[model samples]
Target: MRRTMTRLGTDTIRRLPKVLLHDHLDGGVRPATLLDLAAQAGYQGLPETDPERLRAWFTAPTSGDVVRTQEGHLARFTPVLDLLQTAPALSRVATECVQDLAEDGVVYAEVKVAPEQHTREGLTREQVVDAVLEGVRVGTAKARLFGRRIDVRLLLTAMRQAADSLEIADLAVRYRHDGVVGFDIAGPEAGYPPTRHISACEYIKRENFNLTLHAGEGFGLSSIWEAIQWCGADRLGQAVRIGDDIAVADDGSAKLGQLAAYVRDKRIPLELCPTSSVSTGAVRDISEHPVDVLRRLRFRVTVNTDNRLLDGTSMTGEFTRLVEAFDYGLDTLRWFTVNAMKSAFIGHDERLELIDGVIKPGYAGLSTEHVGAAFFRMEDSW
Candidate 1:
């Protein structure tokens, strides 16, 4: 088993099978799409006049620092929200988002976006839901036509600082068959707790809808605890701050706090967005990411691009960052990719089909290409 695990082919990792459990539809808009949609909608608040400039603005460094700095912090989440205020605009962005993810080598992606944020143009919650679904349907069909297969699932989020979470939950359940997979709460995570939307959480639970809450990112373990124990979240988004509850002993051993032990033992899925986490200051750096510790400890760690445009990343980039930071070889990459596929918010049979039909075969084909020494080196202490 060890030899088989250690000898993962470079080609397999290069093909880099991936499943994204936590990307935001509004947050993942292609700059070109946003530009065209803004023009069609007669809105003129775009940061740049042209798509190339907008793309550069999205990916370029802010405040003069190239690597890590505070110059680009505000540009991360606010730009997407700024441009995605109208329903038609949101729909166009969401549709192109799938195309973008597919081009970036994501086989399956679940994009989360709050419907409430796009209603500035008098769009009802139902209208918002339908429009986003239409976009995903079109995008997925286009992907299949181009021989790049991917299943896009929409997860409706209720802004944490806002009311009417139950309304959003109802919208999610109503569109279950129309590409909507689950319900979530997203927004400023510091002050507005998940308990603020208890009714929505309750509705999701009663309706058997999937739930993933954004917790333990900027906040601490208390936020994570409430999302799981108080709200019954099936998965967690950016649950990086749970590292605070973990302790490393003097003799190279580790001890998990009560919350950490429960979360690890129960195998709760953590949708970790490495670049996004760093941009948001959720962790000190990529190398210090708790994902390595969590993965080695047998936790259900899933890789995601929380916001592609904001973080200037795709699934491939996130995987490459992990590989570089943790010395993760093909085995670890495959493990993480498969873990993401299993944790997707889809039915058992559908996920099985994707894994067997596309993911496994893709990796096997890549495995025959490269027989390198190793791509990354794992820490002995780890």
Candidate 2:
């Protein structure tokens, strides 16, 4: 076995293969693409038209320790969603999303799309789904031409505050064999608990499809409990608040509450997005982030980029933050990648192929002294 490596750098992190489970379609528009789309649609709601300025504007602010509601933070996506009201715009966004992930070293990703939000301009939800899938097809082919391997799938999402979850659930199942792979309930997590969409969750379960709910964000442990115990969620999104159920002794050891114990014991994967968690007040800051603790406790913890544009984060960026904050190594990164692959909605054979064939070898090659003679740190200490 390859020993854990130290001194992993940003360049090394960028080369590592990644899997993303919880990302929003409307939240990750590239600034340049957003500008072009807005121009075409004649929508003038952008906060900044200059790509650099717009990027900084969209980047999550460093709101230290001040807890903010998710609704307010989510309202920022209005302009991007407005631009995606048409099929051509939706397809272009999806295409670029895959291209962007491929360039960022995401080999497999499941992006969430709330088609209901894009239907205001006369496009039916089915048309929206079809357009996005077409974009996925085109983007995958383009990536292949560039010698990049990536498989991007869609997760049909329903707003937690909406009453059309069952309809979204049906849409997900309708395209399960297509580019669609899972169903999710996103949007505000405050008053609209997962139980509010139990019918959709139950429908997904009865169909034997995958479900990952946005929990432990606006709400606390109760939200997580409902998503898992009540709704049978296969994974938890931004489950940072799970720390609420863990108590630490003066010696730095942890005592898990019943819910925390249940979550860990069941290996329910937590799609923890540190940067976004801090930006949304789900976490105070990177220093207080519990991902390292959760990983040490053997919880199924997978790092992710919640909203790439909004958080100014990618998978590698999230890993870099953890490495800088907690002194994580190549092996720790591998653990998170493998956990995400296992938690993916794809079939076991597909996940195994990527893990055994792609992810493992990629890390093994990087860990070797032969490959790292130039940049990677070879010492035991940072």
Candidate 3:
């Protein structure tokens, strides 16, 4: 059965119901917000006082180096982290994150934040989580006033280099009923393996909490393997390196290695952020991103903006890039959205409700020509 195709434009892409699974809270703080917070807190560490210049600084590619290392990419977060020491700053950043995602048509998002990094100015870890949750509440309410219904949940992140993984895991479980939905370990993933936090991952599992590890981005297959086998990651944050296990022949057919086949067969979700993958030197460019190959292989692939401000990208921007590179239409876009909703840490009933009631209906409302045709194929695929 064939259906009439409507061209996917920027406006349509922006209006589609998107789900984001791997955005970073500190990395997404607006330049204007950072400047304002810096001034308020009397923090004079900002390189540029002007918001425009600061925005340029934050978004500019690191150096002219041929390859940007993960540590080099992470260095950009220092200034933003410096500004998020207080409750007000943390709250404002979180609220604005939701607002920005809503404007970009993100129906649901799991934003990751490292509370351990935010405790420098005397705030406890619990207080940091509380502040961010308060901001999410305010942002959700504000988005509703504009008729943008966005469900923003927190994934408390523990820096893999730090010794507070167990503490952060406990904090995530403590606030699971609040606004926090899952637990994660993020940071330089090379030397600091997910195994370092085995106790934390075990704790989260024992408590029946969700966990996602920043694996296979700067590292390789071993990182991905440990995250799944040893640490028991529910999802992989930037599992771009899994592509190493996938081979494409001269004729364009693809083959998955044992590990890749396991991931695909088990429906493990890969939070693939194309642009960020390039920025971190995980992939050469967007065209070479593993997301396209993984999606075509029927692996549970989800598109995300790892850092909106740092990468100068949004859900709309990410989808637009994919559409340009791969000529993806509404159907392909809906597949990614449904993949994310299906992989969400929320209750299965709520996940189905959003996918059937909110997401599919929202997309169906976009084009009169296709009506239900666009999603009908997706219903069976998922």
Candidate 4:
């Protein structure tokens, strides 16, 4: 049998109403910026001398959760973290990250970075938050200057293996109005569970602040279940493991386990990062990804670039991959984007404004009839 093609037209990917929910601050740093910052910080921990080689290095896998191809060795994310210790460096990287995402047509993004990881450079946690906030502020301004406005929010992540989940949660609450939208517990989802930081999560909840957990990426349904039941996360980062609870019958009927059913019925958002999942060995291939299955089951699934650098992907590249892998036509693309917008931490009023003012109008002007009459209802809702 012949193989099917998965490449989509560049125009279609660019025009989609894209919203990114799972990007990481440490993992999404630009390769060229990494070189410049490494030199400025006088850090000599890089694997390659030139930017291109270093770019290749970051994407290549090693003993970490991320995997690599044979010829191109993957670069460990440690060196990148080592270089991004100061506020200025963190700010610059965060600024450029937003610019890159905006160029790829992402209208909204929630960039997460572990503050504890940046403390080795002699800065306080508050200083690190300030630096990243400065970067997002500048980058958002830059996007507008280019005639495109992208809303960028910071989601602070506390490293599970490290101390200070409560400290970081406090930081998120402090900066909530100043561009920080929510709190997350990232790093090592296997041995470290969300319940470890139950107090911190509960504090965030009591304050009525937003929360999203990095569960089900490296683990399974139990991890996801705890995140929702115990931690009460508003969104799940890379909850692909929910697929384990979904059973497909020979007759093509799917049976969702209790956890999966609850998540779907409650409409809890799953921040699905296809390319990053593959890089980290969460899924063997894109076609086998449970995003489509969850979508068909009415699960609130959204697409994201978990780590743009490591995955060698953009929001456009991610959507293109899905289109090719599953023949996901324009309608599916719209659903993905719209779902992301709805699931964004932004308020319902602002989401309505974006849907009415930007997304609906933009897609309608595309005039692609293949998207069908569903577009009509989406537009009318706006």
Candidate 3 on 313-336: residue-level lDDT in tens?
999999999988887877778889
Deviation from native of the Cα of residue 304 in model 1, angstroms: 0.3
Best model number under TM-score? 3
* Worst window of 10 by summed lDDT in candidate 4: 66-75
Candidate 4, which segments miss by more than 4 Å at Cα? 1-7, 63-75, 369-382
State the TM-score for model 3.
0.96
Better of 1 and 3 by lDDT: 3
Off by over 4 Å in 2: 1-6, 60-67, 369-382
Query: In model 3, where do residues sit more than 4 Å from their true spots?
Result: 1-7, 369-375
Q: Number of clashes in every candidate structure?
A: 0, 0, 0, 5
CA RMSD of each candidate after superposition? 4.3, 3.8, 1.6, 3.9
Residues 1-382 of candidate 4: C-alpha lDDT, one tens digit per residue = 1122333487767866678888988878888898888788788888888888888776766644445432122236778888888888989998898888888888888899788888885999889989998998899899889987798888999987777899999999998888888999987776788899999999999999999998897878888989999999999988988999999888879998999999998889899998877877778899999988887787888999887888888999998888878877665676777888888887899987887788766666653434433444533211
Residue-wise C-alpha lDDT for candidate 1, range 65-165, written one tens digit per residue: 55544324544556566666666676677668878887777888888878888777687878888888877888888878888877888899988889889
> Residue 262 deviation, candidate 1, in Å?
0.5
Whole-model lDDT values for every prediction: 0.78, 0.87, 0.89, 0.82
Question: Residue 110, candidate 3: how far off, in angstroms?
Answer: 0.8
Q: How many clashing residue pairs are found in candidate 2?
A: 0
**Better by TM-score, candidate 3 or 2:** 3
